[model samples]
Each structure stands twice: as structure tokens, then as C-alpha cells.
Target: MTPAIYSPDEIARRIALFERIRHPHKLLSEIHRALNIVRAEVNQSRADMVEFAKQNPGMTIKPSPLPLICVIGPSGTAKSHVIKTYYEDVCRTENWQVGRRAVFDFELSVDANKRQFHVDALTALKDPDPEKGNESVLRRRFGKLTDKLGTELGLCDEVQHFIASDTGKRTKSVIDAMKKTLNTGICALGLFGTQKAADIFDASEEFGQRAHIRFDLKGGNPDVADDRALFVAFLKTFKTEIEKMGILISTKTLEDAETIGCLFLQASGRLGLCQRIMKAALRVALESGATTLLPVHFAVAIDRGKLLFGIKENHFASHAEAFAD
Candidate 1:
């Protein structure tokens, strides 16, 4: 039997449904606020760096000529969460009065292959002709955009394939052209990726040196006194917020969550994972037809560490058995 092909109308309807289902305005708003907070943090970080630079005038580091920052860490480390929160916060703070804020996220994962990168970036910039159907014309148009923005266009992602190790000469030329626009201070680039992404910057001495500041989320370990207190505080605060929303969590559930959080901290002590745990617990509660999450809810939420962290399912299963018992 032949597979059914979607007709044009069916395809359009599916697209509409997908957009409606996937695009949650409220969630997007929340995400926007989160990102703005991150941007503010980035700005503050930049300011602090500038002051530090002044104190050490001869320091090898220079001002981040481009607003590009590479957030690197293992999976479930909260790199994406941090970036999203920062982006939302930045947009909120900037758009408060004037309502003029421009923020966009370019997923390098989708365009990690050749041809797609150019298409994605150009389409994002709303280039008149993204096809590069006319190189000279496209360049002129891009130049105008840079001149107007007064800064280089920014790009964000885990690892940009455009700058991959095996990129060819032609690809390099395209990337170089993009870099030239940035060189004139018309754009600022931001990068988000896993620890392996460091190699991308390491590939080029210039890019490597550009990324000077680093933030790594160390999982808060309960065995460690400081981390224990932090974990408790995080859980307690989360509980309070959920309770305020008419959800009351049982002490047993809290204890279970604590155990889970500690296990996570022991394995991958990133705050990002902590947040996800809480998020998962809340989701489980909602799914169980209970306004408050109880121990069972947490149990339901704990599926190895897949829903916990990004740990392998089998590995997490062993750990989960130990924790569940």
C-alpha cells in the first residue's frame, strides 16, 4: 500500500493546527520576560567586566566587540533555561515604557547543515533576497541593515554548523562575509551550546579569546552543607509559589523531591536540572487530577533521570530503583 500524501489544503490545515497547538501566547510572554531578565544580567555582567577591564588596563581581554556569549555546559545543565530567562527579562525591561524591544532566537540545531544556515539567517533578517540569488544586491541590503541597527546582527544557538570544524572554503567565505558585517560594530552575536561547543571557539584563536566570561551551573549537592541549604531554599520557595496557586504539597512529597534533587545534584549538580525537577513535579501533579503534588506525584515524575536530567534512561532507571526503594 502507498503512503498517503497530504493534499495542499490538508498541509495548510496541519500547519495552522501545529502553530495553534505549539504557540502558547502566555508561555511565550513568560518566556519573553525570562529572556529579558537574562539580557539584563548579561548587560550587568558586561558592565562589571568593563569596570574590571579598567582596573586591569593591560588585561588581554577586550570589551565583547560583539554581544556574543557562548553558554556551554552538559545537557540539562540549564543553559537554554538561563538564555530564555535572560531573553525574556531583557525584552520586558526594554519594552516597559517605549514598547520597542527586538529579540529573536535562531536555533543552530535545525540549520546545522549547509545551505540551511544562510537561508535561516537571511530569512530572519528579512533580507529582500535570501536566495543570494544576487550576491552584490544581498550584500548591499545586509550592509544597510547593519548600518541602521548600529550593531552587528546577533546569532544564538548551541553550536552553529556554519562554523563547524569541517566547514569548506565556500562556507568559510560566507561566514567571513557575515563576520565583516559584525566587525563594523553593526551586530552583536550570542552563542549557546554544550561544553563540546568550546571546540568551535578553540578552532579560532580570535574567537576563543573573545569568549572570556563563563558561567557553569554546578549541581547543588546535599552532602555539601552550602549546596544542601541552597537546595532546600529552592524547594521551599517553589513550594510556596505553587501553594499560592491553590496547590498544597505534602511534606512527604517535599521530602521525595528533596531526595530526587539531591540525587540529581550528586549526578549533575546544575541549577537548571533543579528547576526542571520542580517543573516536572508540578506537571505530574496537574496530570494526576490533584491540585497539590504528593509523594506519588513525585514518584510519577521520576522516570530514571530522563525527566530529571538528560541522563541515560537505563542509568537513571538503576538510580531510580535505588531512590524509590
Candidate 2:
């Protein structure tokens, strides 16, 4: 028999059912709610930033809304995770509005020629001509589209791609166009990248001063104790939920899992990595027909992640050092 081809409505219903089942502890629910709050705040901030930029376009120096937050840190400091987490919290506070505005991640890339940078800004605002190729046409229509929809745009990822070349006229023009669009206040932009990327902006006095908030993750600051604690709590909660599903994870194994998790965080600072580790561990345990998660399961998960991330198992220290802090 052929498999059923589900309609969108059917697919949505199935998704809802799965969410309710898998997230009985409300972890996914909380994440959804948090995203909503972040969306609203991002919309408001975007509008405010656009207006401020337009009002003082010619001003060599001007203040921005709060500190334009620039998350700067090493490769594995979880800079992206921090931004995403904050965005989720903002969304949750707003109760996850059905039609509310939101901020989104942006990405930048360069072509093989490397002469120009690409800025892909994700927005809830409808694109009048989703197929429009002309930058001018998009800009002129973007304002009307955003005004009518009351939606906002968000930018993230490769923020450095938005910066135009200092000497090239075309590059400058492109950058100016982006700046003007941002000034319209339709959405707030959030940038997430490595320290080197942040340095690209810092090197330019014009862009450097525009950043309102700078979060440095490499200072060896002890203040992250709270964040670390929260992460540990999240892990414990996740482990409990898995156990309730009839998966028994031993205490020793859980400690080992946590140790591996901390190392992943230290290397990539990506929460996605942490989740992958957990999922892999659970899958391996299930495959073995074992009710409990064992050390081997964690070891397998860590090895899998390391391979995917192009890193080595030896790169991470043992749990002894992780627990010491």
C-alpha cells in the first residue's frame, strides 16, 4: 500500500498531537511562548531604530536604541544560543500571539568572486514582489508592505556581509540602501557571529559606534555561573522527561552525559549541539533495548557530534574538570 500524502491541515494536526505528547512537561510550549515575546520586542525595536536612523541620517554620530547588542565571543561560547534564548524569552512573555510581529535571523554570504556581500534578512513583512530582482523596487515596496501588515524584520548570522567595502561605490551604495531600509523601523536586527566577525564591525569606526550593546563571551568572566546553572537545570529536567518515557538513565551515566555536554558548549557554544548529543544518546539507548542510558550511549553521542562538528574526542577534557567548576 502506498503511504498517505498528508495535506497541510492534516500535517499541522499531526504536529500538534506530537507536540502535546512529546512536550507534556511543556518544554516546547515554553520555547514557543518565549519566541513570541522576542518577536514583539524585536518589532518595536526595529521601528524605533529605523525612525532614529532616518531622523539623524546625516549626523556623523548618534545614539541608538539601547545598546545595539553585539554578541562577540570565541567559536564555542554559545553566542548564537544566547541570542536565540533571549529571543525565546521575549516571545514567551508575549504569550505567543497568533498574528503578532516577530524578529528573525539573517545571514550573509559571499559569492565565489568575493566582490560583494549578500544580506538575507528574514521578515514577517510580505514581499510585494517576492520575485523582484531590482533592489530599488524591493525597497520602495517594503515600506508599504510592512506598514500594511504591521510586521517586523530581523537580521542575524553573517552580519559582516552587510558591511559595504570602504572604497567601492557599488558596495557603498548597497550598504546605504540597507541602512535606509533599517531606518524605516520595520524590524530590529540581531547579529550573531564569531569574534572575528564582530571585529570587522569594530574596525570600522562608523559601524563600531553604532553598536549599542556588546556581549563578550571570552573574558573568562565568572558571571556566567547563573547561565551555567540554568543549563544544568535544563539538562536535569530533560533527563527526567526522558525517564518518564520508560528510559532509565543511570546517575553515573547522566553525570558523564553532562560532562560531555559542557565540553560541547565550551567548544561551539551552540545549544543545538547539546540537543543533538541528548537525542543521539537516547536513540542509542533505545536501539540497544535497554531501559537505562549507559556510559557507552553518551560516549557514542559525543563521538557522533564530534565527527559532525569536525572535532576530535580528545579535544574535550574529562568530567573531572567539568565538575570542579
Candidate 3:
């Protein structure tokens, strides 16, 4: 029997998902949602594989490999924060007991060779002198450690290091090294990088095909209501977090649609930029001994930020309008 081809609607739906994973500027909540989805999927995959193994006794069961989740975004979008938070949380008992590892995290290097990559992984996995071994030995040791650790997930950060702008290029060797390090047929990989690292995956058909969970994250888009609402939620979270450090501000203002919209514009819809603005305002409040943050404080903070960040040309001239009089 011939295989059934997907209809146009199905194909379009698939393409939409593809594009969603490819586009950056995703909100933090969205990224968290994606990670949770990945966790559940890995769990189910583990369960199914165990069941299959029991039923088939002597047979080799090939569980579907988890997709490599490439968290890609611009520099200021809090991509590192997202990856770090998620990665650390995933490294605990549940993942490990399920024969899944929260792989040690390492930053990729531009000048790094394959041997060096292995050495880095081995070190992250707790091997003191991974540099002592050659590629073959390192690979064996690395694989052994992973098995011992019961790690199913591997994380590589700063993947943009593999993209060399000086030569205007990305090398296939680095890509292959990534595959070898994370996907050596034992571990599922999660990579974190900027657009350049994402390019590495898009250009390589083999990598792209396997990277089913590519998460392109960015700051919220100002024009999108859902985006703004999510950012406001993040602001509320920030308020709660900051209060733990003895500073409390009214995130209640963020609840106002007009106020939040203008703040979002000033931030250019980027959470990092929003944090910078708020943190600067917090500093001003700290110095003034003011516990309640007012619109005027944020306006001054925004101006100061323009000079400090060399973003004078993009000043928020009318941001004071967001102030609740």
C-alpha cells in the first residue's frame, strides 16, 4: 500500500509549527511551556520503551529519540536565563531515575576541535582530566559516564561560538562534533545560542531533521496583545522576586492596559530591556528611600538608560504618558 500524503491543511498546520519554532522573540512563559512539553514527551517515550522491552524480552527496542531543543534568540532576550533555569531544574532525580540525564552544561568555543569538545563534556560529567585521552578514548569514557549518570539530556550553550564571523562561516566539523557529543546514540541534546547557532541547524539537513523542538525565543512583540499580557505577567513575577531582596514596587501599575502598553513599547518588547529599565528605576528608588515606585521615577530611569546604553536615538520621549496621574 502506498503511504498517505498529508492534505494541504495538514501541511499548512505543520508549516505553522515549523515557523513558530523558527521565529525568535518568544515570551518566557512560552519557553517554559515548550520545555514542559519536552519533559512530558521524554517521560512517555521512556515509559513506552520500558513496556516494549518487557514484552519483547530479547529484542532491541529503539525508542524515538527526543528532539534537540535549540533555544535561539537575540543577545538581550534572556535566552541564557531561560536555558539555565530549565536545565538546572531538569537535572534532578526524576530525570536521572528515568534513565535520563540532565547533561552537564558547557559553552562551545570557536577554536575548539573535536577532541577539545569531548574533553569539555567529560569534564562536565565529572572527569578531571578529560584532556588526557584521544578522540576514541574520550568518546568511550564520555559514553560510559553518561550511562553511569543515567543522563538522557545533554546541554551545550554559547553555540554561536561555532559561527566564525571573521571567515564569514560555520564549519561542519563543529556541527558534527555537536551531534557526536550529545546525540552519540545515547543522549538527546539541547543547545542554546543566538541566530548564528540556529543557522548551523537550518543549513544542515541532517541536524534540522532531528531538531524537532527548536525553540526560537525573543522579547514580546508590542503589537501583539498576547505578547503584552505575558510580559505584564513577567513583570509581576519580577516584582515578587525583587521583594525577596527587600525592595518592593507596585506591579499593580502594570495591570493597567495603557500603562503596560507604553512600558512594553519603551522596552521594545524585550524582557531584558524591561528588566534593565525597572532595575534602574529600582536603584533610583533605593537611593531616594522611596518604597513606592512612581511613573516619574521610571521616566527618569528611562532617560538615564538611554545615555548609559548608548541608545539616545531611541529615547522614549512620550513614555511619561504611561504615568498614572
Candidate 4:
């Protein structure tokens, strides 16, 4: 049920608040710096190409293979979100346009074959007829399109979909297509997926060498003091953001140590899961006409989210004092 107090505009504002509460993590900064390095390399390559063209008119110049980064992580760590956020920030700040489409992003289809993969890549490139070509034709078109679009970076999510659950020959074909794109020097590649996505590099040593910058996005560990502090700080920040949206959360709602422990346990130290549970609890509380957030709301949220969250035990309900002093 929609809360009576929440108009459509207010609901959108609250959602925006929740979505934008991204914690500034070290990985974010690292990826940003690494992409800057890639941009620099790409700029140098383009400069070299221009100089060569001026020196030798009417000559074909084949660009060298560019850099590649693989961002592998478990589910609920928001790897895709992190990569997309970086690109979005860069494009917005630099006022990038179609002629400067700094990044092209797309997700691989489940069990994606070479044909489907190229079609998806072309679709991301805004091809007028992504479906109008054979696999070989599509592959060449995608390469040309990337060059025409001035794509400096390519972000592919769910990369495991192509590499996993495929025959050896099929896997190599798709991986080769990916390699071909990079070899053309049209764009640097940032592949994001679950740990299984690492299989792409394992299958091809050359791919691994090109993608030397690998980041394993680890979730928090409640047992570690530093990690626990980080999660607690994130929860506090979440509380502040929600309050700014006029959610009327109690001071102790997410600030108390016991509550923090409950959340950590519920989410298995995944900040993404914590955010999900908190958002669900807010919906429950608002629909029930609660003026302030409470543990009971979270208990309900856990119960509702159990099927997907897979927590056998509802920590908020059964043992609220599990982390009490």
C-alpha cells in the first residue's frame, strides 16, 4: 500500500536518496584513477595516429591493443553500479557528447553466443540495425561502430553469462570477439561480473595480460574492527540521508551498535543487502503508518525478503540482543 503521506514526488525523492547513498570506497577511487590512466594512453595513441596520418596521407593505420580491467566480485557488492557511476560522473563533468561517447556499456545475455554478443554490443553502440547481420558481418560492424562512435571505454557487465555454461569452442569464439574489440584499439574494456567471470582470463592468457589491472571487490567482514566500523559508518550515513528525505527515523534506529550488528548479520556484511533490507523496512513502516522506524519493521522486512536474501534465521526477530553489550 502506498503511504498516504508520501506523494509520488516525495516517493521519488526518497528513492533517489537511497540510491545515491553510495559509500566512497577505496575501490571507487582506484578505478577512477586507473580509468584516467587509460584515457591518457588512449589520447596518446590517437595523437600518434593523427601524426602518422599527416606524415603519410592516404595510408591505413591499425591501432594497437588497448588496456582492459576486470572487476570481479560476489553478488550484492554493486560492481556494475560502481563502474557505471564512475563513467557517468566523468561524462557529466566533461560534458561529453555523441562525438565523445567516452564509454559504451552493455550486459551480456545469458549463455550468450558470438552472434548475440555482437548484437548486444552493437545495440549498446546505438547501431541502426543491430540485428541485420550474420555473426561475421556483425563482428566487423561492431568494430567499425566503436571507432565511429569515438568510444574510449567499453563496460560489459554480467560477463560470466558468455564465458560460463558454454562449450569450449563456443567460449573461445566469444572471448575472441572480445579480444578483437580490444585489439582494434577503439576502446579500453572494463568487464564486471561475479567471480566466475574470471574464467574469461583463465581461458586466455593474452586476455589476462591485457587485463592486468584486476580488482576483487570484497564485502565487509563484521568480525574485523575496521570493516565493522566501515559498515557502521555507512549505516549512519544511510540514516542521515533517509532523514533528510523526511523519513522520521529514530536516532537509535540505525546508529546503535546492536542495530548495526543485526543489520550486518542479516546482510552477511554486504552493504548492498543492508541497503535493500533498510529500503524494504522503510516501505513496511510507511505502509503501516508508523511515525518512526523500529526493529519490528526490519523484522517484517527480513521475513518478506527471506526468499531472495536466503537468511535461514531472522536475526532482527529471533535474537535482537545477539550483539548487545
State candidate 4's TM-score: 0.89
| CA RMSD of each candidate after superposition | 11.0, 9.3, 14.6, 3.8
Candidate 2 global TM-score? 0.59
Which tens-of-lDDT digit does each residue in 34-114 have in candidate 2? 344544565566566578778978654432332234555555545555555545555456464555544545455541011
Taking the tens digit of each residue's C-alpha lDDT, what string does model 3 give over 236-293? 6665555444444344554566656667777667776676676666555455445556
Q: Mark the regions of model 3 whose C-alpha exceeds 4 Å error after superposition.
A: 1-66, 87-101, 165-170, 240-246, 249-262, 294-325
Residue 259 C-alpha lDDT in model 1: 60
Give candidate 1's TM-score: 0.62
* Candidate with the greatest lDDT versus the true structure: 4
Using TM-score as the measure, what is the rank order of every candidate, best first?
A: 4, 3, 1, 2
Minimum summed lDDT over a 10-residue window in model 4 is located at 316-325
Q: Highest TM-score: which candidate? A: 4
Candidate 1 stretches with Cα past 4 Å from truth are 1-67, 96-103, 110-118, 125-143, 149-155, 160-178, 221-224, 247-252, 255-267, 304-309, 313-325
lDDT of 1 by residue, 61-175 (tens): 6344543455566766656665555544454455533322245556653334444544455566666666664555555555465445432235466564445446545335444
RMSD of candidate 4 to the truth, in angstroms, is 3.8
- Taking all chains together, each candidate's TM-score versus the true structure is 0.62, 0.59, 0.68, 0.89
lDDT of 4 by residue, 99-215 (tens): 657777899988888898888888888889998979889978886887777778888899888765545676787788888877777577888999888888778887788874888
State in Å the error of residue 49, model 3.
8.7
